[model samples]
Target: MYPASYYYRRRLPGRSRGKGLIICLIVFLMFSTGIGLLKLINIQQAIPKFPLLILGQKGENALNLMCSAMPLLPVSIELNDESNNQSSIQLADILVLRLSRVFRLDRQSPIALLEKELPVPVEVESSAVPVMKAAPVLPNPPSPEPEEPRQAQVPTLSEECLMAVYNTHTGETYALTDGMDRLQGKKGGVVQAAAALEEELEKKLGIRVARSDAINDDVYQYSYAKSKAVLEKLLAENSQIVAAFDVHRDAGKSREESIVNIDGEILAPILIIVGSDARAEFPGWQNNYQFAKKLASEINKQYPGLCLGVMVKDGRYNQFLHPRALLLEIGSVSNSTEEAVQSARLLGKVLGPLIREIYENKQSE
Candidate 1:
């Protein structure tokens, strides 16, 4: 023990120097850590927050600050109370918090801190993120022109007058010309005679004739009734029809009674029949008789003795429908079809002139 003061002084210098070095090192370390933390905070504050672009319904206006780095996303942020600026800020904060959670940000991130402080539930859907494309601008379209009104068309009446010819007993056929019976089938001798008359009236006399090829009734008993309907239809359709003739061949009558000869050519005699049955709805039978008389007289003047005179009967025969209605028996069943055809042609020649005269008289009246 050389002295207690000497040992104490020697140990004290070393210990004091060691303690001072440790304290200075601790202070320096704390100061450096604090300075580094402050620098990090400043850098974070300096970096700009990503601006969210909100598009309006029309897509012609923007709702937030424009940022070049931030990618555009089609997000519908329906802030019904958008007039309040506080609600808008709260929504932005919520969006940032969701982004921070999705990107797995650092625990000390400002966005993450905000997420913890927010009162609303933070449900981030990582799958439903929509990428938005900028809308294209279009030019205005041109207006349309007005259309014109259309005109209506009118129907014109024929220059030449028309005549209607039809067969009452359409099934009355010929014997030798059209094989088999004369009282059955449509291809009858009377039909052929009427067609020849129609052709002569049209081609030779320049008359417009409408002849019906309709088989009125298959059964001969109901022929007159059925033919009346056909005649009515013809007269209704053609207002120009001046006369209607029902051509037929007399059955079971003598050949001498029905045949005639004109200029060395054998002919079928034409008989003009006038219906005079006042009780059968024919009050205008006298007018029909007068027409028959005139027509018969004309036929006789043209071919001398071709007509066998007029016969007054007691049946309507649809003569009441028109004053010029005539039931003409061309020939008997025994007479040949060639004779009947010749008679029909001769009739057309005389009848065409008579019809023109009657029409002219009516027009003059």
Candidate 2:
């Protein structure tokens, strides 16, 4: 029933009035809040009362600053069990923000305040590790020498002081069990050793000699026993035979046997063993000692270190039979065959001269 223009103007005026009412009400509320806050300010008595809730990362202490500033606050740190996974909670002055430069809070018992400061206590365990050092290395040993070869022929027994030499064992005839009265397998090797020794002896003493078969018939005995028999036989037949010797081998395996190569010749370093059996009883292994020293000295002189050492043992070595009788071990079964054979050749070169000297000494006697 009203005109269209009048209705539009009337609606516009109503909207304006509504907007003005909303703006005036908002301004009044803001003004009232500001006056109330200003009236509540008591500068001297103002103290923050809000409880600070500080959550910290595991193993981290963010409340250290607060603890140092407010030593009397009696704050505490604990792990919160309410969390799905337990988390740490650190305490600080919560109302600190409400104060300006400085403020004082109520002093509380350290134990009680700390307990109320955190929801729960946090437990921590720590461990440390030690450093280690590396181990030291050992030094390597020097290598042994190789065997030497001789091309000289052996002297005939008649050409030397003795025509031929034979050996026997008093207690046990053979060198090993199931002994033979006459030399069997050892005959060739013995002859070879004797020939080598004879060659050297002939060169030094100008004597001719030869080695005969070793008797195997009898119970097996050590080489020393066999050496005694050879000495007795030499005394009975030649009467001038001196420097008798028994040759044998060692039982232990050594590096020299495997690697020693001299001028393409392989050999095991020799071990000159002397019996201490006499040394223990007589105190003067005079004969045996002299014998050992002579052998070691002569070998060292000729070969310049061929002899290992003169090791004294507890056995007589059968040297009691005759001062000239001796026992020698070339090498053990563990040694290469070449090393054993080479040792035999070397023994012959060394012994031949010593035997010739003994024969000459006996002739003078």
Candidate 3:
């Protein structure tokens, strides 16, 4: 014979146990949702101060792109007006596109036409309103100056900039893809990333950066000495150059381990190396450390997890030459070239304004 409590439990059929589990699950879900919301809000920043470049890579399928950008779709935020589109993208009304089969319209293509008897021409009463003549067209106003004058001003604006970028380990390469081959020693894949950084700084950020394609590391051990010489020459040539970035790549990681994601886009993690005087005569190492920390913080503020962190090394990795010099590991050997290239653009986005601020301060002094 069973007890009365056992008979009561059998009658309910898990009703009491199910309710407790359901409540706990609901609480867990709510906590998870709250944390996710906080993370999204914390990642948002006011990027209106800089020229906004298209961060997405092309050639990606539409489905993945849509899914990646869905979380960042505008909920309550500010965007540029079409008339004042200083950045690359021009704001416009969103259009929903769908896949469907449609009739082809083209020239020089032969197709059988369906013949139909014409009915007649019917005149409409409101055909020509003639209201446009009453006032000048508000859209597309005449420019005060021609396109030539405006185009010429861009070079003049960026020519005054003093910045330098070069590759210490020019032989460093990354994972390859279709139609993209690896570079031989001397001009490796990392050089393209350095070139991209130089271009982004000049074109997007309006900062002219001198880049050297010299074969620095013909031999592995003397790479630092060769890079130091190159950096010295750059400093000598550009007297006003305040900052120098020596681009390199990290190693000893798998392809999947090397790449990091920020806002759904794949990126190569940036590691800032600040060398100290433990092995060499590096004075004012604290300055470089502080700068690196600030830069890492700024990059994380904009795209969290893209920057690994600032590292202090024992040997002087040619950073002893300049107070603002830094050695940047754009990615590891396992990352793709495209990932490094995109990361270079992101680095320029944060680094340009920081360097520009220092330049302005020096000028004011």
Candidate 4:
């Protein structure tokens, strides 16, 4: 029953009043918070109550922007899980790891602080994932995180690369297990055994062994020829490598016939091969032969006949590269990767004592 203009004007003024009330309430709340924050002069004490107020919140966004153009890294870190704040730390690493994909970071870097640290014992990839992938042929068993592997690195030791190992015929596979005897151009069981030997030696003895993944068996006959080149390069770079082994596989032998009983456990046989001067100019071939003999004797002493004795070949299997260089036929084509790996591990077990002897003696000289 009022005039039309009067009602319209009244409604507009009521809406304006409501908006002003909201603005005033919001300003009052903000002003109160600012005054409360200003009262706390001891900012350090406040950090415990409110962690996300400082670097943990603001630095994360900046870290993401920084690692976008950074290089790959190899990190040696140890995560501290001894506090109740482990969950928060983990959440922080997750946020940072999920934020940027630009860094293939494994090495030590400034951005590494955002991630949890891991010991450089077991092999790790450039990222968080493991480096070892199950071969298509070998049944990928669930990798049990063994305790021994964690206690791998010896506390008192000078970490130096002491030995070099490579596979001349990396394509030699286990036919019974791998569905093929050789992989032609791909890495085979021999390569895996060599890798196992590297890891085992590092774990058990803390000896840094330089190993190669050079695929030299693509053509089979030219394997030695190609591997010689790889060996030359490796030895040239690592001049301190006094000992080298050309890891290979022997064909035409079954699993049963290729094994040796060592300490009640069945392991693949190892054959030490010494090259001759008949094919190539090998000056110190006999020294290598004597070393091979000593190595064979050591293996035999540990587990009699585990080594199939040292075999001297007419061809210079790249033994001419170094005085301590020798060839090792890990197992036959019929041997499984497990057997091969165990055998290689056994070799590492025995080699630790003799290797330390050789190394320490050389260092004294």
Candidate 5:
């Protein structure tokens, strides 16, 4: 009963209908495969790993220490790449570390042990390389007067600085009334961090630290007055108090910035803040810069990416009283108090050494 045309179409077994169906399937499969390959390539192009630029000797020093501890972080260290340019890293299993921060090996620890192990480029060629007999020998420049041996200077903490936490800001007294067990952050306060950083430094570095009144981040007028008062008191009391810090939290969303935690510990990401108050005389940043640079240099060495850069500002966050003060703005209010505390703890670890180095370097000079 089938039509004669249908019989004609089905010319041979596995020849007419079966062959057409097979051809159609092959075309469809090929199209799908092509699309999938393109999609995979696009995804690969989208998620390129971030390039870490470790600049300045301070930053480079910190990375050296970090690499010694954890060798798995994927970074392209451009210390001695032949290009001497911003080299592109091959996204391979190998870690990339770029040493833009130059270190005078003679100044820091031993060159043999540290330098030998690292991939850092060090110029060890002697300046006294013998010239050819035909070349004129330049006489050694007139010898300068011999320098005096210097002693390291230790910073003396002032009594006023010790009592800074006792002052009040917005009706809330700034004091570590309760030790670590009871210190907590108010809705818009950073007393706990100040207290914790101070306490640990005191115990670890044998240096005295004090906390200033908590000031609002938005209101400049009121905040400046309170900040100025604390600075004056510290400077008036302790000439050795080379640094003062104002710690604040940011107001950004949690997703925009977040603190990482491992088990019971919180991971901290500190942001350095510089003010922009143009009205004041002696923005006090130079002194602030000295302290900040010293701290940033040392901490960045101890903990890679832990101590962020020093922010330059035109305003006085009470930094005018002394050049050695800093304003630390940690992650925003959206983050939990625990995150801030975690950051404070990590900060303390490197802060002690940083302070020590600053004082030591000053004395050596």
Candidate 6:
């Protein structure tokens, strides 16, 4: 073994070194733990407070604050004075106190400062709220007026017979089954043609017409006298008859003289003959001639070449009875009765307005 003092000295050095190392290690550990604890505290302080969700009820004036992240804790704030003995406080005042405590806001904050600066409430007696009145309804606008009915454009003549139509020669017939000239007892085609003309004047034109059904062929040589008697009877019965027609058939040898084409419709030519007896008896022959010329002009205007011009003859032809009387000869013996009937219809159309004019003139007179 070495000397005793030397050995003790070596042991003491090792012990001191060990003690210093342990003390240094302990101090470092304490310092690190303190830094760790400080960091943890800083992290906790950095987190924001939970937001409050306020729910309120009307009339009761109560508020509930809800927290989404944490369970809500009940908080009571005294806003009314305890000494005044008031049991309930205004909800607006309670909200101010709760917000101040939860947000840790001071009097300098806007909400807290505004609450302190606002004046106290005053009590007033309540009355019933007035109801809003509805606006008055206006009456409906007037309906537009109904239009007046239109008047007919055609002239309206008297309902009584304004004209008379009679056949002088009842022996006249047509090519439709009946030969051209069938004397005595036969209802001649000229009668049929006259009847068609009568129908158009009375029914279509609203003119009253007097038609003679007499067969004057019993005295063919004295046909004019017999027809004159028939016309006088008609005129006697109807004083309103202002005009008369002695309808006859011509004795033409060819169809060219009697057949006329009007708007593609084949019709017999119409010949109006005015008689001038110039004798002292028939003084109104000039007036009859004037009327026939006017009527022929009108017919020609409606149907070109329909009237083969008016014939002025020396014989009286019984036209002296009426100022408007005339002898109308339809298509010749060569022309069909159908053609004559068609021509008669067109003649009635032209005569209707003419007769109306004459009737009106008589009224004015």
Query: lDDT tens string, model 4, 207-241?
Result: 88888998888898898889989988888877677
Which is better, 1 or 6, measured by TM-score? 6
Per residue, candidate 3 scores C-alpha lDDT tens digits across 1-365 of 77999988887788768766755653443232322322222222212211234213232332232224443322211232333332212111101000011122221111100001112122335756544556655788667874553333234233554888998878887755322233446587789889989887888777888789898877878888899899999998888787899998887877677889887898899999999999878879999899999999999999899999999989888888888899999988777888899999999899888878888888889
Error of 4 at 279 (Å): 2.9
If scored against the real structure, what TM-score would every candidate get?
0.55, 0.43, 0.56, 0.58, 0.45, 0.56
lDDT assessment of candidate 4: 0.70
Clashes of each: 1, 20, 0, 7, 14, 0
Give the CA lDDT, 0 to 100, for residue 70 in model 4: 25
Q: Name the better of 3 and 4 by TM-score.
A: 4
**Cα lDDT of model 6 overall?**
0.71
Among these predicted structures, which one has the highest lDDT? 6
- The residue ranges of model 6 lying beyond 4 angstroms of the native Cα positions read 1-156, 278-280
lDDT of 4 at 166: 93
RMSD of each: 24.1, 22.7, 43.5, 33.8, 42.9, 27.5
lDDT of 6 by residue, 21-110 (tens): 755643443232322222222322212221112212331111121111112112122322344222222332343354455445562344
Model 5: runs farther than 4 Å from truth?
A: 1-189, 213-221, 260-265, 276-279, 361-365
lDDT of each: 0.69, 0.47, 0.68, 0.70, 0.50, 0.71
The per-residue C-alpha lDDT of model 1 at residue 250 equals: 76
lDDT of 1 by residue, 1-365 (tens): 75899988877898688767755653443232322222222323322332223223321232121111112311222222335445444444444444445455553574343234333234457667786877887777766666676533322223544677889988675554665446465657888888988887777777778788788758778888889889998888888888898888777766576678899887999898889875577778999899899989989998999999999988878888888888988887778789899999999999988877777777889
